[model samples]
Target chain A: MSTSPTARRGNAVGDAWVIARRSLKHIRRQPEMLTDATIQPIMFVLLFAYVFGGAISVPQGGSYKEFLLGGIFAQTIVFGCFGIAIGLATDRSTGAIDRFRTLPIARSAVLTGRALAAVLIGLLPIILMSAAGLVVGWRTHTGVLDVLGGYALMVLFQFAMTWVGILMGSLLSTPQAVQGVAFTVLFPITFLASTFVPVDTLPGVLRTFAEWNPTTSLSGALRAQFGNPDVVAGTSDAWPLQHPVLYTVIWALTIIAICAPLAVRAFNRATGD
Target chain B: MAIEATGLVKRFGDMTAVAGVDLAVKAGSVTAVLGPNGAGKTTMVRMLTTLSQPDTGTITVAGFDVVADPTEVRRRIGYAAQDATVDELLTGRENLIMIGELHHLGRVRAKERAAVLLTQFSLDDAAERVVGKYSGGMRRRLDLAATLVATPEVLFLDEPTTGLDPRARNELWEVLDTLVDSGVTILLTTQYLEEAERLADHILVVDHGRIIASGSARELKRRIGGEQIRAVLRDRSRADDALRLISEATGGEAAFDADADAVVVATAGGAAAVAAVAGALAEAGIEVDELALRAATLDEVFLELTGHSADAAIEEPV
Candidate 1:
């Protein structure tokens, strides 16, 4: 039997925090979430910055170093989202969440804790990758405050996207389903934008999609903050800078708004011993 | 009330897993739900624990409406699923402590309760070991400990000892008995008749999503029809003679146990028939070794109600 939302466990924030602490404990013991979170972002930064950066030339005399860090930063945190989906799916399959359904703690604790931990985990990778990028000749012309804000902004994007992945995981039938869904959703979302290539170079149709894509907005705004050289282009290029960080925040909010409730609904339906 | 449900109904698509059923479990009693697999015993336990919802029933657990006040019900009740659920990465102590936290116990209280429960369940030795490394019995005990960390007023244990070795099963029984003695109302489901016979103050036999029988162990056992007498003869030659006398006394078929050197017969007149059989055996000069009269066990009661032999009830198609 389902109670109304008001009838669920005590305060959602209070419950979410308790859940977050428990999740942090789980992460500490397994250590894999931390390792994966750390390793994933590094791989994204290294693979793209060195291998493909040379071919993608910008009119601003793009030093592959200056050109790639912002996009790679976005990739680093976004990649961390997969861990959220996989972890949640694993917990569901193992009956952990089923057991939680009978507990008095807040109902949102399970997913919220996971999403929050993924954000914390993403922070480690962001720092590690940023350090690694700096060592690799990557440049960010933004001031100290801008750098800190940009990093914090990246973590928030990871947090929002983690919930999206969690929504997918909680709703899917299996972990393998999460794998397929995560890739099918994430790969296109990350790639159709300018993660590796400049968006302007693509065909008219794909270029329009890329320019409008949330991912490009995220990377573009970050790039703008870091003072990465930009080329003056058509109407689409202008949109990425109008509200520098607006697009990323809008995207993050949109995902959290839609997926958070869906996740809560899906998890609430998991009524079993 | 520990558990109160009216018109409890649960459905999964075309199939109704738990039909419209009513159940009430008084506080501080061990109520066993007995049934074969697919009989809704698990479903009923699930609903009582607030794990599943009946499509058309009102359920109040520990004085809170389950549909409208699940969090309160959960706070007051502890549930251990039929399948053991534990975090493999966490030690038994950690699992119990986490559950205590979920139940909103304070840090010190959670640890105190965890330590007490681990020792009570005889899982203290393995408290620090990861659950994935523990034996099935230990894991089951740990799961129970996790459920009990909050000292809930109601406890729901589903198929509590389904996969335990005999020694482990007995150990769990003692633990359960102690918990029940402490005034914890327990609602359990089990396919093991002996479990029900040993632990339940009241037994609920459910089948095909409905309650078929409900009573105390003694009352249910007495409903199995008649007393049984088993007589062991010294020689095979006396089997025919014994059969003749036993059939006349029992007014039914006489079953011979050649392996145990025994013949089991049922007699309606119980003690009088035993005296008559003893006299007939003495007159026939057939020495009997092991002559015993036994009341019906829960196994026998199960057979009588379900219409299957107690020994061969677990048959499956090849």
Candidate 2:
């Protein structure tokens, strides 16, 4: 042949970027794909901040609107799982995975690319919700370092949640199946935590679960860093609430430690020869 | 050989999808694996393209072992699957550019190549349009263009024209013809005998996960005694006379087909035998209800070799 196929070896990060760009373009073309990160979080802010803001109260003396933003940030970041799961499942069903497998690029690029894009997509809700928070009378009355640290924690938690999403996407066979999982499994998991309310008000059994849940710790950590209402120290015996930042770090690392390799293994098994 | 395989076998649980098959395709030549739906044509293509591992086999494409060096094999080959595997959300040009970038072509070169391929595939008008809005034919063309972004040496097409209409299929066939002229080795699978007859330099007829026959189209037809001229008689009483006249005219043995109420004779002569039979029958004052000159179709060849119709669906073991 006059133009023989040239061999070009691709590095993992570069290859992953190319794959991620494809998904990011999908988001651009179908902005509806970001509904979970954009429209849903804003709707939750309106629902909880206005519709239910009057009925609920923070544990300590603080504005309920300010307390609600931290929880909203935590809840939306966790739901970042749905986007990756649905994206991977759609690629699998459409035979796009097969096409990628036949290419000379690094095999891990497919999953890593989706994970990278998910984390980036996770930022949309954080930014949009922060704007919504300000409009709803929420403020972070803290120094720049503490606010940066809180945003850092949310991104770190988003990275952890991306792995969980990879695992779910690998296990599920279809986008419809992923949707079923998002509603039946993930929806309940987010609700069971202290996302919209204080753990102290939950039922006895659920209160313990909420205090230990990563979503609760993440929310509590954001509230503490933002100088919003939080659990009064030494009053509650729950260690996770007292040390929310450290607990959230532990939870984030633990999740990545457990789910990352399992997600990779599951993805390899699903697409392997 | 551009592609070679030996003792290829793949089993899914209790069922064998490809059973001890072998192949050797020469450089710049086209080979077609002709078969029914469940005849393991796709399974074999998957193995050859390194998309699936064979339980027992050795396959080498472009001189690299598929099992031992799949990356090398992947670098030299392109595959267009039965399904149009392009992303629906991406525009045609964007899809090609993405694949080009994945192939590690620099961004400038990738974009330039995408433009060229778009125009070549007659997709320039819809280059910026998302593939979700493209017609079935356009999608397949874009899928084919994506595979050609790197100008792969060996191409594997699994039923490339399976869902396309006749005009689209012909257009694709013409593109393939040009590729072959430029010395690209192709291994394609199809259920259409006409497709195999038109494009394949060699044909392998697969059934029940095994190749029951292999040769050029003409050779396979010759094996089934070349063309057959069948004359359905208007009157049953003239069957013997018609048979005798047909045999005399064609200088071949003619038989009475009780099931079809016709006299059938095989001939190496193609259309000329039909003229001779017509003249002889007219001279004898006999009228034929229907007369036809036909070559052995891939379906007829399958029946001749395996005693089953081509459309008989074999249960695919899950």
Query: In lDDT terms, which candidate is top?
Result: 2
Native-to-model Cα distance after best TM-score fit, residue A202 in candidate 1, in Å: 2.2
lDDT string for model 2 (A1-273, tens) is 224456467788998999888878878777677676688888889889997789887656678888888888988888888889888988888889999989888899999998898888788889999998888889999999999999999999999999988999989999999989888976766787778877777788888888788888899899999998865364467889889999999999999999999999998888775
lDDT of each: 0.77, 0.87
Measured with DockQ on alpha carbons, how good is candidate 2? 0.55
Looking at model 2, give its docking quality level: medium
* Candidate 2 chain A worst ten-residue window by lDDT: A1-10
> Model 2 off-target regions past 4 Å?
A1-4, A232-235, B229-242, B245-263, B267-294, B312-318
List where candidate 1 sits over 4 angstroms from the true fold. A1-11, A53-55, A230-238, A241-244, A271-273, B165-171, B180-183, B235-241, B253-261, B279-286, B296-300, B307-318
TM-score of chain B of each: 0.84, 0.84
Predicted candidate 2 versus true structure: per-residue lDDT over B96-190, tens digit per residue? 99988888887888999999999988999999999999988899899989888988888998888887888989898887777667778999998
DockQ of 1: 0.45
Docking class of 1: acceptable
Give the lowest summed-lDDT range of ten residues in model 1 chain B.
B309-318
